[model samples]
Target: MDVARDRGAVAIDRDECKGCGLCVEACPPRVLRLSAELNRYGYHPAEYLGSGCTACGICYYVCPEPGGITVLRRQVA
Candidate 1:
């Protein structure tokens, strides 16, 4: 299996997630998923699936909570 090491990155705030699965469903690359572990709020937070984040901001846009998903877009120069 191929996993992205650091090409693209996304930061998920576990504490703020409500396990709505919106971000996961909105992710075009399918890089986000509900973590098996629970967060402080006892919800299955969205987690980065290794790599493959395109930084499209779909997850961020769909996320109901602010700052829930932070997308670090790959720099192209």
Candidate 2:
């Protein structure tokens, strides 16, 4: 099985997100996407694609909603 190598990870807060798509657009690796399913607020929330993240925190900075996005960088051994 082939696994995608990721330098970082993203965590999206579904409830906090307003489906603005800013983070998705700002993502450098294009690893973020809007969910097909609507959130409780009847909006499509942003989600992480599980790979290709560079942990640049662009998503977090671009997101208008506080706590909507969290970027985690991989620890160097």
Candidate 3:
């Protein structure tokens, strides 16, 4: 199996997410997806694909909920 190198990371606050797919659509690397499992509010929240994020912040900017998505850029040595 092939895997992408970890370029960045994304944290999605499921509680804050309202199932809006803006982040999923805006993600450049197409790493974001809406989970089938429902959250506490019974909404499908966005989840990271575990890799391929570019730390572009498009997901963070597109997310309607404040603090819903947090992008962390991998530090280069």
Candidate 4:
């Protein structure tokens, strides 16, 4: 997990997403948004605008493909 802005947050690679909708289905905060743009593989995957996330890792764990989701929490430094 990576840290961002001391908000216990991380970054997500929207391009790597496969649009399986599992992440969207699993997101507890409803942070992940389905992009209208489709990837090279022809799936309209999910995208995070970095606003609605609640730091829940449901999207990360439920994603069928690897790198489809990433969860970052702030390090207690």
Candidate 5:
């Protein structure tokens, strides 16, 4: 695998996602997952909890809902 950029702490807004699971499925690295844990929306939004995502923007692009996810920058592999 290529060097995974430590793009700080990425996050997903559970309140925005409809639990469609598109982002999870769309992840090329399969780093996302649909959690049974529901949020304020009462829907299980996708979650990213691993490391070294490569910062490929796959999840960001896949998220149809705007402002659903936030990508940050980090200095670690």
Candidate 6:
């Protein structure tokens, strides 16, 4: 695969998220969005939509809850 074309993966801990939508708005790729389903916390969690994730970690940085979102960047070696 072309290193430049590599896409990253995003993992969100729905149970911890408060659905603040900070990460969703901060996402440059527009890959993140509020889910239709409610989490155990009764808040609609952020879900990853089909898009090119650059693994910029903007979502992780903007998240209020610690470790609520995890981003795995595709490293080119």
Give the TM-score comparing model 3 with the true structure, all chains together: 0.91
- Between candidates 2 and 4, name the one with more favorable TM-score: 2
For candidate 6, the lDDT comes to 0.87
The residue pairs that clash in candidate 4, if any, are 8-73, 8-74, 19-45
Summing lDDT over every window of 10 consecutive residues in candidate 4, give the lowest-scoring window: 1-10
Write down the worst ten-residue block by lDDT for model 5: 1-10
Q: Which candidate leads the pack in TM-score?
A: 2
Looking at candidate 4, what is the lDDT of residue 17? 76
Query: How do all the candidates rank in terms of TM-score, highest first?
Result: 2, 3, 6, 1, 5, 4
- lDDT of all the models against the reference? 0.84, 0.89, 0.89, 0.69, 0.74, 0.87
Clashes of 6: 0
Query: What's the lDDT for residue 24 in model 3?
Result: 90
Regarding lDDT, does 3 or 4 come out ahead? 3
Q: For residue 25, what is the lDDT in candidate 6?
A: 99
**Per-prediction backbone clash count:** 0, 0, 0, 3, 2, 0
**Residue 40, candidate 3: how far off, in angstroms?**
0.8
Q: How much is the lDDT of residue 31 in candidate 6?
A: 86
* lDDT tens readout by residue for model 1, 1-77: 25444456789989999899988888888888999999998999999987787677788899999888888866676
Off by over 4 Å in 4: 1-10
TM-score of each: 0.86, 0.92, 0.91, 0.73, 0.74, 0.86
Better of 1 and 2 by TM-score: 2
**Model 5 TM-score?**
0.74
Instruction: Tell me the lDDT of model 3 at 76.
Output: 83
